[model samples]
Target: GAISYVSFGYINKSVQPISINGVQPTENNVKNNKWKIWSYEHIYTRGKPTGLTKKFLTYLKNDHIQTTLFNKLGYISV
Candidate 1:
């Protein structure tokens, strides 16, 4: 058997059949198995964000945009 690390959304969209067997990196699963997860960070300089940075951050934080990212792009929001 082979194991592939992919997001839940991706699995749903895959043409080939995949089995989760109730295993996923949700909050509970990650807590129980810390080593099975990784994370991404957004780093910015001190002081209030300005210009394109502000706009980009705002766009990324929008509920609709976040929902699209999760649903269409297979991204797990933090």
Candidate 2:
């Protein structure tokens, strides 16, 4: 099963930013798990908590939990 991805919006500050890219087709040149990418601006995930640190923390937790579960279940190549 594919885990739900949580988006984070606005941290540094920018205008007319591009939407964040979701899952990728190829894993080539990917830097992190599930193929993370950098975007000009971010949009908050559905039901994402609003705030400065809490939102960031929530996303981090979600990512950590998802990856940890995957790795534990032998989802990783290694």
Candidate 3:
């Protein structure tokens, strides 16, 4: 078997079977900085975001969307 580092979202969305050989991290692991692999999404703008960009940022910050990212997409909230 080979070891690979990937985001939880990738694993969750995978179409094929993935065998996890070791213990998976819990929320506590994230809080305590025990988990090493982290993924981030960033948006860069010349100035403050506005219009559709602002709306999109707001939408991503919504509680419901965050929950969905965790429950359905397997992404840990930061």
TM-scores for every predicted model: 0.49, 0.19, 0.67
Position 61, candidate 3: lDDT: 82
Q: What lDDT does the true structure give each of the candidates?
A: 0.60, 0.43, 0.64
Which 10-residue window of candidate 3 scores lowest in summed lDDT?
12-21
Candidate 3 per-residue lDDT over residues 21-44, each given as its tens digit: 443455556556565445575668
Candidate 3 clashing pairs, residues 3+ apart or interchain: none
Ranking by TM-score: 3, 1, 2
Q: Which of candidates 1 and 2 reaches a greater TM-score?
A: 1
Best candidate according to lDDT: 3
Q: Which stretches of candidate 3 lie over 4 Å from their true place?
A: 12-23
Residue 51 lDDT, candidate 1, scale 0-100: 88
- After superposition, the stretches of candidate 2 with alpha carbons farther than 4 Å from their true spots are 1-50, 63-78
